[model samples]
Target: MKKISIKIVYKTLLVSTLLTTFSCKKVFDVKPQDQVDITNNYRNVYDANAAVIGIYGQFQTLADRYIILNELRADLMSPTANADQYLRQLNEHAETTDNPWADPRPFYKIILNCNDAMANFDKMVADGRMTSSDYQQRYSDVGAIRSWLYLQLGIQFGSVPYVTDPLTSIDDLKDASKFPKISFDQLLTNLIAFMGDGKRYLDVYSTSVSTTGATNTSLNTTVDGYATNLFFINKRCLLGDLYLWHGDYKLASAQYHYVCELGSLSTNGSWLYDQYLVQNGDGNNHVDIYYGNSTDERTLVDNNNGGWRAIFGGGVGTLTGQEWIWSIPFDKNFLPQDPFVNLFSNTGGSYLLTTSQLALDNWNSQTQQNGLPYDARKLISVRTINGQPVIMKQLYYNVDATSFLPTSVLQKQGRWLLYRGATNMLHFAEAACNDATLGTSGVKLAYALTNVGVTRVYDNTWPAASSLPTDRTNIEQTFLDAPYNLDGRNGETPYYRGLWYRQVGSRTRAYLQPLPAALASDKLGMETAIIDEDGLELAFEGQRWGDLMRVALRRKDPAFLADKVYNKLLRDGNGNAAAVRTKLMNTANWYMPFKL
Candidate 1:
């Protein structure tokens, strides 16, 4: 592979600079300006603000390729006929040097921007141009973003040239002597250290000031008169992910727990649990199903669109929902137009990709809590377009009632969901389930998170617990004790019911049945269930491959990932399924070739 120069990599940066006057209303609306030397640009707060937005502008360019690499390479998505060889090669696991998505330059460009910003921020703080408080918030934000980008690079490319210093030329990267390539494990270690224990970094930014009148401004603040935390990365969430990939389950659980607790506090307790599925007066025993006036279970009625669908399509409210912790928004009016419209939409897009049969079959194979066939999230997540299954999560806010298609493509504005509530809860459960100290109790909590709420898991009368030993009552009470307990029933506080009292299991929220009690003590079984639940709940959102890779690596079982991708290919009728599986079994074939 030929080495590319930094000049060629960030040519766009040289042609136009993000020098627009800072406006809280137009947070991401960067305008083109004649090239100015960025070396002397970091002098004040507004400059820091512009620098942060500029970094995000570069980061926005990554949305399309990020989703393509993460999803298409996994089992949930496949290239469509319209897709070019570049995309098809990804699904086939045969990507060559020339594939556009295979290039690491785009990721490095954002890292470069982050590096430059952080270096300058440090200088500003030392020279007294930026206050320590201001530096702490902005510097940490840029650092977390950099960590996230590198993690993505590691996930896709196995070993990456981990460069920290802002490079004067891309040629420096070509010289392995200067920037030695680091393996994914090494990268995780470096990032974990960089992110620290999450104490020095500022938590969620607030709109309010301290009693001393010290401003608490951060990238999480409202933009365009609307509250938005989507533009910035969540520090704890990123740190937790780093720890998770590094095999530090206890630390990972703690970080994830912090995010969950913070979410509850920030949302006034309504954010931790999944939204309730109200059971209308129907003869059905399920909370999610509606049978109209008929008693027959087969009778069809209107499907409730607001339950899980609202998380994506609930408009501005979606931004504030507890589910979304970190996301990146794209506006058509902006430099990086909404990428998914072209990638996922058939009407207004080229439709380069579609939901794979494997994903569809996986959803269909599940039984809902109502004993109904298929999960309801499938309806909101995927839909038929021109007789092909299109991924609807990114394109539409809601499905059309009559056509069952997207009401319209979100052409003007769309979001790249990076982290959310399910991510926090499930990751915590995974860490707990794997931790040696937590044992079967940990497995029980993990099942509760995936199936039903904690209340039902601890219920002695619940059928699933009837087989347990009589001596287990005391152990179960410890789980229901203060601090660790999460009850789903109304309590003494007025807001208690509104908060956690309405809690349901993550899978339960999707109308899926809980895992049988037989697997509660089975660590591998619970881990597998958690990973599968990840797919059912968060599929097609750019996390499939990472989840598979992390688990496969932890267990030292290459077949874990190979089998899934292989089965997906077989389901898609791809002739390469056997070949791909054979190659993937070696683990070395899991990553793309590291070419410039």
Candidate 2:
């Protein structure tokens, strides 16, 4: 049993407290706490609110490490010449204990904050300092944050000390007898049970408090008057992820389905299905692609045109709100400044990471529905800056529109996207494809979701439907029923369209052709397509390695993940491709060394 020293706990608490004190002043409107007296802090609702904000402040520190560890270890990202030895080691899957990102202390610091807050929140409710409603909402919020951090720990470290009670010192974690380390699978079970069925958690902040000028100002309001859903975690999405890792396909599908339904309700149907796609000149729905004139022929669309890049660029408005489920905002004015500007920007940034050549090849291999030779998303995702290809999604705000290049002046503020619409739909499709109860219908539904979307008119008579008997041709009707139906289709005299009618599917939205008809019966092939689509849509947003790792672990196929990373390195002309592949073929080698 190795004694891991989490010396950052007190330091993180002090830093996060100071950071949240100023950052949350505009929104929560609470006074700064110069000192965090954990025993005496739960005096009122304001204190509870500040505590939760502090947790987020600490969690925000993990943004850079999260993206770097998740993306670099997997495909789609390569270290640049300017990248330090640590970055190169991470990319090569040969990280040593000296790598700062390998330390688990930062993650536990946030978890410790969560545990302390939840304990005090319960006491606040019991002492009549806060209402039970407020306690439940805030407690569950912190609990979800803890669960998410543990999940990341499990993903990156293989096994971790599962601590729930607030600790007096980090040294207690060193004693294996007192706090036993648990495997990733056991961690999932605990998280799934802790998060529950998602009914107990509050969907949004509903507390009303009296402000100086206004009476009963709802805390559900946006941050700094911006319509952003960046402050809290989505309970259902976290539970869905837990179940997905736990191998509970039906439960995972249900959780993801709830998120989709919530998205529909929250955005008034605009966020549903492929409604985000625009109707192009071809009379078909497609992701808004910006093709410049013949002389400067390249994709250069913006948020105004509903381009795919809008998902990452603009303020948290309609375009971003529809896609980004949960995000962590980092501003230059805040204590923890935006980290991406330094990692991704070439003009004013260190330019440590870039899009791998394999990702470019993956995007270039696709033919769009318009008969274009390459995927339009690549144009929006990666742009050549200073003769080097940089991930442009998060750096859009710091780039010049006319030249579509990084600007010399950088505004160090960005959002770390956690969960979103496309991810929800993809997870649902993946779960449905695996659930035996759904059968071949699940495969068709999954394919349709990633391709052209499910519709009774088009999909009912789809050639793939033949795989199911006449009686079960409409077997997907089960999903069409209440609670599960994402498609707005139902039996009525004058039929009104559901969410699926507007759904053009992820691939179709990217202007890519639908998968082959034969894949409808091939579950493995369908899963591969879904994972590939994940790489295309969610690249560099920090979910790549997890997606690949989850699928590989599920199928017990290390080669599935190994081959991809090997191909990425090989394409980049890295000599370590074979060695990396050989190492990754062993499941134990997938995770980093668990050190404090």
Candidate 3:
């Protein structure tokens, strides 16, 4: 009943590195016949325990890739700095797509994993290494995992080869020659049905496990085998996330909401972590997902690749956030955050990344007050420099994309409240209040207001003040000049010329940074075109070029600034109508093609 964050037992999935691995050992290696040496060896419960533990091991690998690629997919357009960038590309655009190179991987890679688990585990469930036993009964239970994996791929790609013929699709017949995904929605429908069948089959089998005399007495054995079921059960939650991607918010909301009900909220930190054999792998070293570091340890799970010191300079800060809900915990024995990881995670564009610099003129100045009160968040929430409440000065106030940053700007020491897994108790005190002024849709907002002694029916809609909230026209407005000089204690004044970023008056002028395409090459391992403009959201906004695409709101050009500034059609003196028409006609060539 104790809440435990899933991070302790989670892992990302991966296909075998060489064309032969399917997360764990090669499927062929685990084929019933190949296991000829091991099956006869499970004479005790310990061996059986390994079988289940292996399943969790594989889940960790699968989970890793699953979680990271998603970091790419977070909804950016929405308030969350999140975006389905890749998925959006896949969905909105077609054949002349930016990333067709990935066209079939998501589907097959998963199928390969599911199939591998099934084939290997099938032999054991049969109860006999050879002679026919209850294999059919257990196969369905195992199949649930496979079915759900297929569902994830199907929902995203539309058409996927069904699991009914997984063996033939992957083996007897060359999968290389077959299309891994078919674009019709029906594949999604069928795959979902398969998942249901697998789940039902599993439920019945679970009941059987509970009653049968064949069961072993060791509790850990049961817990370990739980991995197989974990793989399938987690899929149910995935189905919810997938539905949200497809715009079925109603269904998606219900799915997530339901999972919250069934799967008790995860505890902040968990201790049931697995330490795989991958050296330099950040996956382990963190025992649980509880908020705040119980002890600091560096992990393969680290964002910076062991170079935080040289990169971000020195002890910057640890990565902590309310959004993590779950995270790889670090204890010294487990992978802990190193000073290096701390340093790298701290560097940002300017005042945002650096620690307090009293050398600057106003470093010791009294805290600055919020210039605008129309928006209650800025007025009542954040604090001033010396010691008073004021609007938050950081860009993307509620969000921190960069992990490395000074504790001052990073808001590390405090804000730890967000990481608390406790329920009923408020995590964000601000959201609990109903600031008659803060645009909120319900009383939840008012709860926080009472702490301020204000009371009223919580208004759920955005208050008029928020509709057109006022912010510094540019970063410079706060300083003596414009964007370049630093008025805040957090950083040194920055300056650069023609580089598209530099100190100007008091603000950092906003312009599209040059994307030197030449820097890209197979040898360099850098992007051919810095799709991430590296301008507006430099410090932590993951990629920039994608943002320009979203901001311009042009479905046609994934290329930056050009769409917003270049009005090709009106170019006669005004603009060239013919040129504009020509570009529009050539839709396929517009977006900068990423070298996959």
Q: Which whole-number lDDT from 0 to 100 does residue 275 have in model 1?
A: 24
Off by over 4 Å in 2: 1-35, 197-199, 207-219, 267-287, 290-305, 404-410, 456-458, 463-495
Query: What shift in Å separates residue 447 of candidate 1 from its native position after superposition?
Result: 0.6
Any runs in candidate 1 off by more than 4 Å, and if so which?
Answer: 1-34, 197-199, 209-217, 267-305, 318-320, 398-411, 464-500
Candidate 2: what lDDT?
Answer: 0.72
Better of 2 and 3 by TM-score: 2
Task: State the lDDT at 328 in candidate 1.
Answer: 66
Q: Model 2, 1-596: lDDT tens per residue?
A: 11112222322222344334433332222333333334445577666766666667667778899999999999999998999999999998998998998888888877876887787787788888877776777788889999999999999999889999987556668889988889999989888878885435747655455434343333355545343245688888888888888888888887787666664455454444443322122211123454443133344354422566666765645466656778766654555767788898887788899999999999999987657778878877997766778788777665665575555454565666777778888888888888877778778778777776665324455654444233333433435443345543433434454555555566776667778888878999999999999998889988999999999999999999999999999999999999999999999999898876
Candidate closest to the true structure, highest lDDT: 2
lDDT by residue (302-388, candidate 3, tens digit) is 222121111111111222221122221111221112111121122322211111111111112212122211211121112233332
- Please report, as a residue range, the 10-residue window in candidate 3 with the lowest summed lDDT: 272-281
TM-score of each: 0.86, 0.87, 0.37
- Pairs that clash in candidate 1: 6-170, 488-501
Better of 1 and 2 by lDDT: 2
**Across residues 296-382, which tens digit of lDDT does each residue of candidate 1 receive?**
444443333344555565456542254677776655445566778888888767889998898888889998666777876777688
TM-score of 2: 0.87
What is candidate 3's local distance difference test score? 0.27
